[model samples]
Target: MLSTYVDLAVGLVLAFLFLSLLVSGINEGLVRLLSIRSKFLWAFLRDTLDGPDRQGRSFLPAGMRDVFTALPFSRDARPRHNSMPSPAVLSPIPEGEAVAEGELTERLYERVREIDHPKAKRTSIATLPPERFALALMEFASAEPNGVQGLLDKLKAMRSPLHGHLQGIWESSAADVNRFRQQVEVWFDAEMRRLTLLYRRYVRWVVAVLGLVLTLVFSMDALEYGKTLLRDQAFREGVAAIAGGGDQGLTALKDRCTATGDSADPYRCVTEALSSPALVKIFDHALVGVAVPQNGDPQVKWNLGAWWERLISPGHWPGFVLTFAALLFGASFWWDILRRLTGIRSRAGR
Candidate 1:
């Protein structure tokens, strides 16, 4: 009986993993389609370099700002049609503080030219590494006669909070050029971590909204699904069996697809993996069995009317909320739990 309960729990978690995977796919799609990474990066860069003043004015010297304007990632360097709301409009950054991650490198510099310069084409860059960003900025500073010192002077002139931060880093290194660069890289890395946290927060809200919609559309009442798994022994055992191996299979599929040197389609590999037969089986078990026809037909017909009825049903509300709350844990979280539970099941079986 305890084993049966474990199987039931595994079955329920497996069901959630499937739903979370679908939601993750949708979130990734939305990110790419909207160029969310690019816009966020741009905003972050703006906040970092320009750092708003107490009066909310840009601290970036006009000369330095012009240099930034010429950079490939800058709004001025791209087509106007590709523009998003200005950093100020999106959200105000703290004075002297830059917003997020991405190394502004010579490669991105060159790539920007290839994509846009000589002719205004393409939207914006999707990613930049922190080390690359530090390298590129150092390269820019190298052009100055005073090199790193000249850069520090420029920073000091701004009297922005960043100047104080960089000054401390500079003094900590005994004003050594190479040490300063390395420290700057570390600083950028810290900023990137903050950016990642911010992005996750934004994604969490997106996931919540998506989870709610999916719950309603698929009639995935978690409470009902759990009850079903508990009552149906054969189904519970089947799900447990699949859960034991699903993670390995999915991981293998992703590894294979990613190894194929296809840079143009970042998600094609994932799409292939998610469309596997195992996922279909999970989907069928989770959603198809949720509702039964009153007329004794085995086929579960889903329609607006049926969905609306469920939406209005007071009993279904808890299920909807439960499902939505479960999804908030995200696909990766569910996958990890599924992997562990599957391991336990395998050990018990042995």
Candidate 2:
């Protein structure tokens, strides 16, 4: 009995330690996986918006400009130009250049004012500024059938350096984006693989722990069965009777015979002893009871039924409470591990 108690205590301690380690491993794995995924996502977004220039001077639409500015990239270092270059260099007509440039500037300013102040009383010209309207006319002229193909052929032949620069910028940006996306994918795959391995390890640990617990429980039961066999009365008596019944079996039996109170024959005494309630209780209690009392006489009749009743009585509520507490603790620990594993799987899937 003392050994059984010691084994139970050791088993409980080992199980607790095993479960704690399992839970800690699962939590650590999930946390690392999540951290990797977060870093990957942030890096992907940063690469997408910042481009390969890294100087934050990439041309973008107004809305896209706002988005890029919101990212972590540094602002453009060059100052923005608000006006066109001087006209003297644009045209070298000494006599009429000043008057022509002044009239052109005045007309352009007036046209911009008209476009900005359009109303029901405003002049019509598609409500567009003069520069925009002129650009649209130029685009239409460029698309005309008369010389559009010829002009395009000539422009292609020229192969402007600005076009090559823009193309190179675009290609480099695309390659960087592709590289960033690939890196993100690789990171994600690695994290998922790590998490999967962790999950498998956790499952294996749970299985091992469960197997250990079951083995312990069954071993305790087997030990209890062995103890009962050692303390059984009928088994001991059978062995003793077998050893002593060699030659005087019939005479010994006749000498031990007596008149029964319930029946008439002396041989009925043996049958009465066999049918005694005390003998029945001994067998019942030894097989199914909690504790076998170590009385002075090893062959004395044991009250196996009363022992069972005492062990399983409702009055032993403390045992039930302890069992319930252990179950609750185990359940909570299992639930925490399960939740952590599920979260890791879900995140990896994402």
Candidate 1's displacement at residue 241, Å, is: 21
Each candidate structure's TM-score, on Cα atoms with residue i matched to residue i, is 0.60, 0.17
Global lDDT of each candidate = 0.58, 0.35
Pairs in clash, predicted candidate 1? 48-98, 103-129, 103-133, 104-133
The regions of model 2 sitting more than 4 angstroms off are 1-175, 220-350
Question: Clashing residue pairs, candidate 2?
Answer: 285-304
Per-residue lDDT over 1-350 for candidate 1, one digit per residue giving the tens place of the 0 to 100 score = 78877777787788788888889999788766655655565556555654543456432223322322322244322223333322221111222345222222212343233333221344466456667766655664665567766666756655534567677887998978788889988998888788767766766777888888788777777777776565455433444455686443444343445675664343554444333423233334232443333357556543666556767889988987888889889888887788787764545456
Clashes of each: 4, 1
The TM-score of candidate 1 is 0.60
